[model samples]
Target: MRSIEDRSSGTSGDDGSSGDSIADAAKTVEEQPAFQAVARGGFLMGGLVHVLIGWMAVRLALGDSGGSADQNGAMAMIAQAPGGRLLLWVGGLVMAILALWFLLRTWFAARRGHEVKAAVVDALRWSGPAAVYAGLSGMVLRFAAGGGSSSSAQTQSATAGLMGSGPGRALVLLAGAVVIGIGIGFVVVGVTRRFLRQLERSGALSVGAALRITGIVGYIAKGLALAAVGALLGWAAISADPDRASGLDGALTTMAGLPAGVAMLLVIGVGLILFGIHSGLRSRYQEM
Candidate 1:
């Protein structure tokens, strides 16, 4: 048998080799051209969603109540278009791939040998996009399967169920707080122009002014919308009124009822469209 020191050295060597192998494999996958392409498609799908939602919001601002101004509404609108089902399926797969990409990024960040706190922060940041993309993929697939549900209705139902129990109500409030934090984060990212960090340096510089304008307007609008959603959720928990817990559609509708809401909604609508355009640009220039 080997001596104790020799045994420890062998074990450490084995662990290090295994870790290096896994890291290399992950990096390889991340660098694959096909994976990168799919991820870019995901960005376009996201941009399309924002564009549709913005259009609906603008229509609402003009007193058109044709549809709900949310993701479900957007999905429904697509379903009515020619070849929409096939498009939904393709979009769903792309978004799922993108979600996988984000998850891999999160894994890489966590294992990058950075300081523990920094690694954790980086992992958490990537995980947020992973979750968002995954949720969007699910929404798309649900519609593709012809089993889509109204987002506002789902929000209200979930809120009501949670409000039925003490722990659940607490959980709802916590969720609301988390959403608000995310919204604030979006605003920060926009105002600080931090999103440019994810793009290729050369590409970003080429369209610097256009990218800056659209990104700022888009992120701020999205952040405000999310903030409204969270506030309404919190209010629902406090008032024991789940009806007020409708998602984005409800948030926009509520805003419309306020004084000068039409103008506000119109501005937010345009801002969201600009955000969508920014996402489209990101699809081409984002760092894979």
Candidate 2:
């Protein structure tokens, strides 16, 4: 009878272990999920922005060359080519569609009181403008260099170049440069300890220090990635390499054809998206 009891007890222990395993599996599935509907919209918007920018670049590449052209001129002059028009038409249509998608998502998310979702969606809002700014910046700056500000090339150079040719110019340019640097710095600092402190004061981040730390860590990781991107882009721009593509998508596409660049860009974008998702997830977890 003692031997029989021992066998039954061992069987119960094994069953308990199995039950625990199942519970753990279920928790993992629940905890590790894509952000609810809103995030999906943001992701799509970013991807579309990248694609449209790439399409613009590819179109420029296929355009007519005006001869004596190096890479920058080649790209700009390509705009004058026949293929550019088609690309512009199709690209414009697609960008509009994507923009509408973004607007609708933003509206619904806001209606649902998803502020963080709104912010994530707004970041994507920059994507289209960023692409346009990049393409035009390249075209105008490269094509006319010193004397084309009024000639349809309203790129960042004009804004970023006000420094130091004269006392007034120097101060203005310096200030502008400072602001631009700070803006980029926020991408990484957005997840910093100081930011958390500020948030705590404002009651924006209320999950206590532990969850805040994890969330900050995630932000810092994203910031780190964006930092690398910012560095590469900054270097290429500072060196005045007109041949280089404007954003990561453009840069990657130029460095390695569409497929590889798209894959790399996708990974980077997804990582950032997930980092944003972490905040919402943590809030949900806390409620539980």
Judging by TM-score against the true structure, name the best candidate: 1
Give candidate 2 misplaced runs (Cα > 4 Å): 1-184, 187-192, 200-214, 251-270, 278-288
How much does candidate 2 score in TM-score?
A: 0.29
lDDT of each: 0.87, 0.40
What value of lDDT does candidate 2 attain over all alpha carbons? 0.40
Query: Model 2: how far is 36 from its true place, Å?
Result: 21
lDDT per residue (tens digit) for residues 22-97 in model 2: 6566445333334233323333333333333334333433442123112233334434667654443443443343
Q: Please state the error at residue 17 of candidate 2 in Å.
A: 72
Each prediction's TM-score versus the true structure:
0.92, 0.29
State how far residue 285 of model 1 sits from its true place (Å). Answer: 0.9
- Record all residue pairs in model 2 with backbone atoms less than 3 Å apart, i.e. clashing: 63-78, 164-170
For this target, which candidate reaches the highest lDDT against the unseen true structure? 1
Q: How many backbone clashes does candidate 2 have?
A: 2
